[model samples]
Target chain A: MGKEKRELTGAEIFWECLIREGVEVIFGYPGGYTLPIYDALTKYQDKVRHVLTRHEQGATHMADGFARASGKVGVAMATSGPGATNMITGLATAMMDSSPIVCITGQVPTNVIGTDAFQETDITGATLPVTKHSYLVSDIRDLAHSIREAFYIARTGRPGPVLIDIPKDVQNAKTEFVYPTSPIVLPGYHPPRRATGEQVSRALEMINEAKRPVILAGHGVLISGTANQIRELAEKGNIPVATTLLGIGSIPDQHPLNLGMMGMHGKAQANHAVQNADLLIACGMRFDDRVIGKVSTYSPKSKKIHIDIDAVELNKNIKVDLAINADLAVVLRQIIPGVRVRKHAHWTRKIKEWIKDADRRDILNKKTDVLIGAQVINKIWEGTEGKAVVVSDVGQNQMIEAQYYGHDEPHTHITSGGLGTMGFGLPAAIGTSFAVKDREIWVVVGDGGIQMTISELATAVQENANIKIAIINNGYLGMVRQWQQLFYNARYVETPIYSPDFVKVAEAYRMPGYRVDKIEDIIPTMRKAQAHQGPVLIEFVVEKHDTVYPMVPAGEPLHEMVRRPHVPSDAKEN
Target chain B: MQHTIIALVEDKPGVLNRIVSLFRRRNYNIKSLAVGPCETPGVSRLTIVTDENDSIRQNLVCNNLLKLINVIEVEDVTNVPTVIRENVLIKVQVNAQNREELKNIAKERNARIVDEGERSMILEVTESVGKIQATIDVLRPYGILEIVRSGKIAITRGDDRPEIKNGVAGRGTESSRATEQVNNYLY
Candidate 1:
């Protein structure tokens, strides 16, 4: 048969584009408005696997996990109104971490769009800020193009979530489908390329001229696949590398230059090194307030060389002496060759000294009465032998894990960085296990954030994803409380959180669980959790009012760090 | 003297209250606003049109809008022939004496009478700036019992879609085209 010019519905065309885009699976649920798309999926069942989630939120989180693990565009489908709204939190989480995800939602019929009919919602309006981009396809002819654009936007540049809300009438209308062979043509979207020669030269000059230079890496290093290059740069320049919470695995925690995560819950040495540096090379990081702490006082002794793909981030928070707008990978490739192998023995010794001092000041020593968050994370990491995908919810536990866990690979340490999204751990862990079924996935969450989306435990049970959950239950919004302690004159405000019996909640979901009040029970319970065939929840009733020290107060410069109240000298004397 | 203001706000309960509270708190007059979804989910967009000139509006967008977590992106689209519209529903006091006159006025303004009662009339108007204002003026004499107006929602005209590229409409003159191209590639 000759290539027949046959008309197809928008929903069909959208599916056809997905096939061309090499989509292997989609997590979603069917609804009244989205039935047409589900109908199309029936024909493409062999090529695309569709996992029906218990709720739209679960479906989106599953897609996000799939994207992070597979390094491909994750797709989720939902119907209009509440279904679309349900996916909002998941979408925001992916956006903050720059995870690539494509969300397809069905809208009410075009004619009844503004009428607020049954199951009708303005999803395009609802998801605008959280998505990297969104499309409201009003015409059948635009379906193929819109779908193509959605995937393209999702996977390209600083990858993030994109939404395509297709009105029911548009899905039903017929039009000739012609899948674009090339990339979608968008007029406004452009990601920076590798830094130019001049930029590389300036960076190299700054590196050579500085007495003490430090590399502050964020998640961008992994996203850009420049971890090896970063190591090379660090090794050649003999520069110490400090990471943000999301940047945990960008460099191995065991590396000599690695100073661990820097922030409220950062190590004393890492925080001190950042403050004392003469020049700071910040890569693929947005200078989150947690890292810079009191921006005005941060790194007062240093000149910042800010390198990021997004230009708006250059001088956004911490001003820079040299700004390079380029993809981390591309810029790293250029700088690798230009970097000279020079030893900063004096600087290296200073960092080493700080590390030794920090080790002595370990708050979680077996003798301590208080259950230290760091000790729990270290024990869990040791027990898992670095085999599990560690997903952390935002707060003190997240910071502690970032400091303690030895992440050796990309996508292994998953946490919300840019958005600092709470209630992200459980769902993300659920999604991660779905992506890597054979591997162990552990979700490290705080009491406050976990409660926000604890409902996702039901999703885990339904999916039969055997993820291990560790709740660092401190009976408060740990991160907010830390800030209030440091910046708000210890007003405490509403940071205190009262929670239900997490063990009972887990049992209700048919998941085995344990509560560990004593530090001694942590390792045994974690081991028991790991051995379980299905999902398990291990709650650690940590001490309340335990501040994550070495805090860089909000608006304070990075250098002026607040050392832990009990310094190494004080601890040694005791 | 036209200004474009964009706002990024949290997508949560009572967000509108927080936004309304902001306007009330600042006492800055908002002439028109277009709010919708942004590139991410669980976030809302607010595009404000104000009488304040470019510099002052820029300060509001940067300082006021950017400062709010619920408020995300603020841009001034006044020069771009943006498609701005508002939905207004007015319940007017109407009796047999003025019913015909009110109907004639609604017809002239292309407004529809959604519901009617013996003593009250609910008139709905979905229109551009001038027509919406004109319709509101005509109803003032009849005594509007209750009037509800949605903030302006807008999109730039002529296929300059922001969704296709991240920085298309927002970038200033110097690197607008380049920024759009880069955004397209990255997206």
Candidate 2:
């Protein structure tokens, strides 16, 4: 009838809290400051699995990747000072994309928290801007509740990363741990879940009245598990759907109404549809500058309706006519009953017309001498049957992956969207490996980004992650080079970033690594990667001059796109 | 236009630094900020004023402040029907010649001479911002030495208690999904 009597040290309570929270694995690295938890981890090694990452950033990204892939809150751990500092980028990335991840970092002993003792840093102060919430726990009694609160805050109301900075003394202290069976109730926090009837009716009236309407589905749809609801709403209304870069796979990419990725490097029809639509229904997506080129001209004819779970995101950019601050699934499901099914054959045909010259403009058309970035991704797409969880680094390869990968399921494609942080691919894919044990995990990275976090290869090998890494080796930071070639007088200053022998590097990790250059070698190389028993790395030397097409230069209208240059057969550069 | 915002936050170390940094990160300048312990056991209230004209920017700052972990609630109390006050202590240069004049000004303004020196005297007053500004205007006649003033702090007037939804009652010691506990407090 009273509290259960269980005596445990704070470190033991740490692992016990994780087990109670349903955490099956942790991606982390141990250091001096984290000895207590690491020591306690040894006892609970059978209860919870821990994956050692080469770098703290890699660990957080892995956790993020796991969270994205499994639709569960991922956990990362590290020690004090640099360990917590290194997690900044990953935590920021998770914050940007609304990924649910909890990072636990060790602090110096409570006595020296501010004295700058060995390996001590004011992490809570430093990470305030990036994390949804953070707790600096020095008392053993507060340790379990802080962790429980961290998990709760990280996963609810537009999921994000939460940090728990536990001092070594707290971890070593012993307390009567009653593993908080009751939920943590923070007075100030509440996640909005449902839309008002008036807002729904207003949205429906706009939907019914529109002649040319487009639905912009975003990553929120995936987070809220509303892909089916979005599909139903789109299908019932016969509205074409355009996806943001992170919004990819929210709806089946193969669906007829799915207009593919939209924004700067989005497909032609999708961009055109957003520009021309009379009514734009934005579901679970924020209209970032990357998605909407110029707020003044975006969807010029549309009366916009923005539906998002984060109330704070509505009208932050591109003010909408009707804003529904609620869960995407809740809003979509509520409105589906009130929504009337209709046909918009002419509108769909109009959009299809913009997609007319897709064949000649397609990357598949480059079947000549050397390999292109898109071809390599398409090959992997074919080998994996468009079902693999494709994690990509930012830049040219990221764009090409978007252009080529035929995503068929939600949570199948993970990338650094809001932050667009480079060097996220390898570790994130390794994290995804733990999530879908049976499915293929592919890493589409660039030569430049691969070098940024190449040390992650050690983690991949250690975990024996069943992943296939395809490095689009262009011998340069291709995205910057493309931007230079287009905008700044083609001065390739510091753009030609050379990388060391990646095959040799992969060899160091003891995984089979191959360099594929010829266009014909793409498929065979991808197939070989799939056949490898463990993680395999393939460096495909692609054309350095290649660029992502349909470029809507920043600050310009979405309708204004610069097409790729046409090279005649006689005017070959190579 | 100026905006005055009141925020309730958890009483913890480095909270002021966090709030100030958020403003700095957004490149917004704070005119003044005053913080003190509230009636609640572990809660402090912050009253901040910034010289920003745009309501949208003001709302954004409020939203961002609300996102901070320790922040419980934020409200723009400027131009509202509320009880607002600031305290000012001005140590002004004086002699037998100007002391009578300074005393008259202080008495007219309902101020008091809390401290006095041979060459200077301190005028202390707790009043509305408008009254404080008026008093400062009156004190300007005398040579001012050092001035220290508390920033604006406010509470709503009358039966207009804009729900302190994050009351002590919300932090239940019982176990429940954070959301389930939050459901009772949803506005």
Candidate 3:
């Protein structure tokens, strides 16, 4: 391919490499520093579509959402200095959530890099703590290779964001455009893929020996496309599955063995099962503080076996009895063969006994005068038949959505799990729209998180994304208010925030809208959203003081959850 | 316990910053760090010594350092059979009567009086860590005007480390990395 030795500017080669990498859409806001690449973009517009985001942070989030939904590497770009700096939060969010994203930032010319020229920022340096890997291109010849390597690194081995900072000089410099088709060898960067045979054997033995084995499924199951494998293993080994928040749809919510999300705001039954389990097999999920509160005392009865792609994750937080550093798919395939086909009927019965107060436990069953967030989400779940891709924002609304939304498919629930960034829902839903054009997309956000990224509505309008946004519009920042109510004397310091007329905001975007202050109108508004052909926003005015229950406050033991207010003795009949 | 880690990284902008950032992120306080070009033109060696005990913790740092894209190799040569050297420049106040005496001490220790002023004498010494410590101890009695010492840089006591390979061998991509084709050749 190089015999002809075709000469091209770095700008042209950059576009070529992107096209080769199967990048159909790029989300970014352009600037002077990246003018060369944008100027070269004119020729590649037909092959690659550029989505102009209102904020650089939104661009990164969109890329993250795209990658999360599509299972492909997402790309975001921005210019130097603030333009690059703005992508920091999104990068961190993707890094924590293990989203594969390639962020390209244009830098000041090489001659002026260290001198801090106008619009110059050491983006590579600033993002080193956040990104999986970063590259600063000094020479034009390295541009193609850097991008190729960046993509490879970003998409592989506990995938996370990788940044490529290209100086404007390098973009304009002439070079023989050699887009390396050959895989770049990174000897030091090999993620330990081949599972240690001894570890796998030991894991199998532990699985067979245990009376109550539980699978703590994490985001890795979805990332590695091992949902089926995990389900098969759980069934064969008679292990109950409890997922982390990011592991939402790894298995169907209705699956007999699925115990929903397990964490601070997880279901009571899931947390209870985990706390009581004898053998805990962690698949792709790190025992983060949020999940395993008080690591020293968390699940003390369990013999832990952690299987992850990154070796760094194991023994970093909680040391397991047996550790297998391999892809979830690889580890599961090997272990499934050796796993005994055993049924723990007594354990399943014990788990069922752990489930209490069905009506009181469910958010929808509460007899409340004010419209509730959970009731609205449950109605939407019914309206979409658990088929819509639900992208939730941070706070009370995100937790409520997780609890209420029933998903039948993996990658259906996309939210900022690690960073828990607010304002992630709307733009991310827009990205999910692009990913699965046919599937109905729903953005579940609180009154607080929505306003942070309200500008992305215009981008969604421009894209004509067929998305339905349900704002759980409580007058205050619900989660913070809940915390204040629980811990403090309910001082409500700067917690009760006011919001603009969200229905008007939706109409202003030329989208359809509705307001549901009444409980009876909740299902009607959801029906209208599901029936609408284009983007729609429904403002569901929820109870301001309502709090998410079964609350294991941060750093508290998983079993030490604050249950909901007392229920009537005949509440189960309701 | 202080552990010395040697890392070889691609000589590119922000590589040093990346290494420093990793140390900060991992909450490892850097005691001293010195870096310079290694035998490879495009590669540089970084000598980073940090206060750390557990061998497992040291191994974790090495693994993380090697995980960086530009980082080619990382070796915790703290306990290895190695030569650790440090250079020092000491300036001491001098007088006519003590000039000969100072020279006698300098000769005893293989240190050279690089610059000798009638009022002051500047001495330069490059020695193993132990020797440098001994020299500093011997010279401190004359009331050192000022002394500057470079951080310890270590190398294993062997013929040499292997030559730096240009491309990653384990990267599973296309098999088109033609061995006959010179990778660094200009168009």
Candidate 4:
């Protein structure tokens, strides 16, 4: 207790506050401005561990991945100027996904802040839109509270990333550190944890009256830890459950009533169920344009009920009949008791008919000599038994993973859904490696995305992170190429990209690497990579001209998706 | 439809920038805005008037403003019974012939000539936005040298509103009784 009376430097206070916030690890890189904090880290080495990432962007994504996988606030740190700016894309990705991450950046000395001195930048101003909240700490006394507030705001209601940019002068200044034990009282921030009884009753009434009900589960179900509650409601009411891309594992894929993802590249049956349902219960999801295509005709027959933690998301996209702004699990807990066990045999049969040829349309059944991205993903799924924490990068590979990799557990399928940032998978998988110990972790990235943050392989090797990366090497920016091929008269300009020998790159990082072009080699390469003691990479040479199927063109109705040509029966677009 | 929104925020540096940045980022149109110290020692009040008619977007903007950690409370007073005012200063070029005419115009519009110089006279007026615009329009013929207007500020009427304490109070009621008391004493 006498130690508390002694004054602490701001650098010590920064680490002290983080320790008080229950932070065990930080993903960061050090520079001139952060030298003092790094020195302070030497003092608290045993209490807190720092992972030295190759780049600040990778650090941010690693923090984001940690947050998404473990449901705890992830921490990332960096120096000023370029370092802070590099974290923008990752911060934006976390913002769009509602991941809880605390990003700390060391700023230039207070005297030189606005002089545009060496490595100085107005990061707080630049990151205002991307962060849920941010603090620029100039005073020594405010450092602890600013960090405390940052963690509180970042982890509370509808969690997202928050940043604290600490000037070097503040880090060196001395102050008596008092970690505030009183609960944070921000008069402006009140995250509702429970829905009003009347709203819950109204939702139940709408649920009970509809003959066809489809519950659209989203990432909030995972964040709120309500997958079981969601399944309970769906099963009790005989409702089919559809999910947005980020909502992949809200309901177990093997469950009888679980319809697959519903969005731009969602399954045909999932989209059809949403379009034809009489009551659509959207839980913990914002109605992104990708989810509700052609908003004017989206679920014309459904009396929609939207339940989300963020109030702004309730009516931001599709206007609903009842909007309940509260925690999804709490709201479902309220409504579950009153849910009537109703029979929808005819509606179920209709959905079954819609799903009859889904398996046939899957790329696995195709007798293709050339490897396709979907087939490779399916093979990886078989190799991992679909239990690995799979982080997918954006583009056609992302869609292929979502389609073929069935996640039966919540928080197993993580992707950058809203911002759709490339280069997210590798560092993010590394992040999950630290979060859940002894579990298999995988990063499914495309040839293009993997190259974007490919340098993180060094960080992976340095951390000795047990992560296996599957690069779906299509030799082109496959998604954009698909768009150009279908919409721009097959103009292939600038889409085909050149990649170095990925196996050599992996070898350069001192890890085992494999390249698989033939279909028969896919599983063996996966086994070899999985057997390695540390990080490994497998470059999958897929067909150059394959496309993701069941794609709803931009702004098209969800039900009118383009089906794959090889499907036996439902090849015709509805 | 125009909404008169009042927000109570922490009195700190860059708070206004945060609000303005939020409005700009969200694409919310602000017709006029004003901020000043309130009864609270560490709290400031912001009066924002938006002409956008989409209630859904307005609600979203209000909710977003509320999300700012510095922002304490936000109320859309568009439909509330409130007393609204704007302060305007109009500088007009005056000559021997038009001086008397300008005086008559200012008198009729309930505006006072606060400063009379050799080249021009400045008319000071505190009125509703529509009245202030009308007063400026009438003085325009005398060759308006310059004009500046304080954006609209509004406070809800009646005693049911929150009472002003040492450092915080309900946004709309803090100044209503003070304004009424000053007006009654002046009359």
Tell me, per candidate, how large a share of the native contacts it keeps: 0.04, 0.17, 0.20, 0.27
How much is the lDDT of residue B70 in candidate 3? Answer: 75
In terms of lDDT, the best-performing candidate is: 4
Which prediction has more favorable lDDT, 1 or 2?
A: 2
lDDT of 3 at B35: 95
Residue A397's C-alpha lDDT in candidate 1? 88
User: How far is A332's C-alpha from truth in model 2 (Å)?
Assistant: 1.2
Rank the models by lDDT, top first: 4, 2, 3, 1
Per-residue alpha-carbon lDDT of candidate 2 for residues A1-574, written as tens digits (9 for 90 to 100): 2456689988999999898778999999999888999999989999889999999999999999999998788999999999989999999999999899999999999988788798888998888888888889978988988888888788777889999999999989998888776656676676666777788888889998888999999999888878888898899999989999998987897899999999999998999999999999999899999999988998898899998766567778887888777767777877888777888878988987887655446657545688888878887888788888899999999999998999988888999999999999999999999888878888999989998889999999998999989999898899999889889989998989878898998998899999999867778777788888789999998888887898999989998988764443533232
Model 1 chain A weakest 10-residue run by lDDT: A565-574
Docking class of 1: incorrect
Compose the digit string of candidate 4's lDDT tens values, residues B1-187. Answer: 8888899999988889899998898787889999999887888999999887898898788878877878877887787788999998989999887888888988999999999998899999999989998887777777898999889998989977643221111211111111111110000
* Model 3 chain B lowest lDDT segment of ten: B178-187
Candidate 1 TM-score versus the reference: 0.75
Clashes of 2: 4
Write model 3 residue lDDT over A149-233, tens digit each, in one string: 8887788778899999999999999988766766576644655455656777788889999998899999998988888988999
User: How accurate locally is residue A78 in candidate 1, as Cα lDDT from 0 to 100?
Assistant: 94
Q: Candidate 1 vs candidate 4: which has greater lDDT?
A: 4
Which candidate number maximizes DockQ?
2
Question: On residues A114-166, what C-alpha lDDT tens digit does candidate 4 reach at each position?
Answer: 99999889999999899999999989888877887788778767889999999
DockQ of 1: 0.05
Clashing residue pairs, backbone N/CA/C < 3 A, model 3: A185-B168
Ranked by TM-score from best down, the candidates are 2, 4, 3, 1
